[model samples]
Target chain A: MNFKNFITHTLLLLLLALIQIIFLKNLALFGVAFCFLYLLGILNLPIPISHVPLILLSFGLGLAVDVFYDTIGIHAASASLMGFLRPYWLKAISPTGGYDDSAKPNLPEMGIGWYISYSLPMIFAFSLVFFTADQWGTGGFFGVLNKSILSSIFTVVLAIIVQLLFFKRRREIR
Target chain B: MLRILQFLYSLRSFLLFVLLEVLAIGLIVSNNSPQGAAFFNSSNAVIGTVLKTRSDILDFFSFAQANETLILENALLLEQIKALKQEPDSLPIPLDSAFEAQFQFTGARVISNSLRFAQNHLTLNKGSKDGIKPGMGIFNQDGIVGRVKSVSENYAVAISLLNTGLLVSSKIKSTENFGSVNWDGINSKQAKMLYVPRHVKAQAGDTIVTSGYNAVFPEGIRIGVISVVNPASDPNYLDILIDLSTDFSRVNYVYLVENTQIVELDSLHKKSEVVNEF
Candidate 1:
């Protein structure tokens, strides 16, 4: 990524984290689903970013969230797992024609179908791990499953809205 | 050697993944341990400040409800005072000893509260500097809330009664049959009371009050009302559900009750246990 792109991504990540902590932290739908909008930062990274950096970035993002939520390492563990599996998920869902090198995996660039298919699994994976670790031993299996699924759906919907509203569609400069 | 190095390099991401996850698990395990205390919790300074600020903003919107609660509490206190004045010599022996003097109450605002989780906690604005400490009982006008878990300089974390880990010694006020109340982690508004004998007559709406068997709470403090009474699977006991008096969703202000004689009482109890061993 170029220096300008790096700077932009960093600022966007910070902004998303701030929004998650200040506004979205207390928000729950029907007292079950919760929005973890901070995941947008990790999900939208440039496809070419290396595995180590990606994992580190996700760990940092999760730790930032953990600090605010007072949840210790639960978010960090989930986000790290999500980051490690992102490349494999991308490969599994690669278009028949293959992905363009410069295009970012976002709603506008990847289209809604591809975006949902890609983001949903990633978010679900994160939520499953997050909730499992969070409610371990205390919550029954059904309780963990309930929280993970509901929270993932809530997060994904908010993420889609955020991407559609704020992320401008970039023109290919071929 | 070259082949092994190549294989290791190929699995670097997986290794990194495992390493980070292990580290994260380590943190969770360590922090949740009894010895971990509240170092990484909402009661810590940075998170506490943020939550306190948010609660302050939210508190503005609940002024009317808060006013109503205060008025009701004031009237109750006034009534007690009037009764005492009317019959000074006839005052209850417990009241004659200055019931208020044995406990010091510090008012606190709850900055962060969670009722959805299996184990829930409340972060209060009062802390060590405010004379708040672990083991202090917290209550509001409606009823008992919980015991303080840990305290920072300016913040304290209380284990909410809704938490499964907290068991309150309670009794049916009408019959004086004692039981212990604990959250089953299913409902936020209801808790289970155990150990009341199957033969004991308990009905829905019977008041449940603290037994004060544990010195954390003084006797006769209101806890809740029995909502459901059922025969336990074991014929020896009754399963009773209680509707908590404190509506945790709207509870913002609370009083931390510090018992002046707790230390002495605790020592006396320990001495009796030692004597029993002899």
Candidate 2:
């Protein structure tokens, strides 16, 4: 990757992690505390980033957080799943080669509507995997099911907002 | 040899990603077990300092209100002491023998608190070094908050009733019904009290207090008011939901009550347990 692109990705990745740790982890709404939604870093990666590398990057970040969070391998697994599924999602949501060739995925390349649609399913799936794996035996099978669904809904709502605000709008698709 | 060099050169990025993921997954798997140590714990220097700074900034607004609350509580406590001097009847009832050795009070302030979860923990400004030990009762002006869990120098953590693992023994005053109060993990305004006998008459506004059976919190310390009572047909217990007297979401400062004579009482209790075990 070019230096500019490389720096941008690294900075954004760290920034997302910083925001997740500093703000989101501490947020308590209703009685249920929200989960960290930092996996958007993997999802927002430029299409040029190879799928395996993207997945690995997300897995690494998620695993690091898992250590601090005291949860098991669930986050790593879920983040990897998000990385693996990103290509399929881009294909499903984008209209045939429907991306700017030389630009990163942002609001300008993918309309706000398209971007939201693209991120929702990816985030929802990752959230389900993460919550289900953690709450697995703790809540029984049904408990896992309950946590997966409940947390996905919450995670998606928050993730979409992150995309809209920070996935910056490129002036012109290169 | 040529193909090997080509493979390494062409797939280097992919290999690096795989290696990175492998390391992360390894850590996650390790932490899953019961003895699995905390991996991403915020106690790390980089995360801790950043989190601490941010937590302080967000709470700065409330620190002022917390200060006011502490001042108001001090005033109220002073007034109660004055009233106690003039009229002994107004004092919290002198403990009956069973409870005489169970409860003690020590003052503490919230060094850090977590409320945004299904289970929450609070850290106090006192710890083992300050003679504060785990399992001690933590309370505030309105009522019970939680019990101590872990302690370090000058700081201790309490597993708040919001935690599912916590089961504090409590009783309803008027009916003498006893139960364990729990947070729904869904509501800060309320908690669930279980094991209350269905036969007892429980009504809205009836007082629920700590039973002191656990020897952690003293008996008759206000827990909450019974908001609803639901009974299960298969069991003899009733579900008692309480609107907690204290807004747990807003607890900033608290009193860490240390039962000075815990060692003596615990030994006696264990002796009885050992006999029963046989």
Task: List candidate 1 segments past 4 Å from native.
Answer: A172-174, B1-6, B86-100, B232-236, B274-278
Q: Point to the candidate with the largest DockQ.
A: 1
The digit string of per-residue lDDT tens for model 2 on A1-174 reads 789988987888888776776666656444343655787677668877777677777777876665334343556777877787787677777667676677555555666677668776777787667655544343455644555556656766676676667666657666
Docking class of 2: acceptable
Q: How far is candidate 2 from the true structure (C-alpha RMSD, Å)?
A: 5.9
- The DockQ of predicted model 1 stands at 0.60
CA lDDT of A23 in candidate 1? 84
Model 1 TM: 0.90
Tens digit of per-residue lDDT, candidate 1, span A1-174: 999999999999999998987788768788789888999999999988999999999998998778667577888999999999999999899999888989798999988999989998899999899878766766688977888899898898999999889989889587
The 10-residue segment with the lowest total lDDT in model 2 chain B: B32-41
For every candidate in turn, the CA RMSD to the true structure comes to 3.3, 5.9
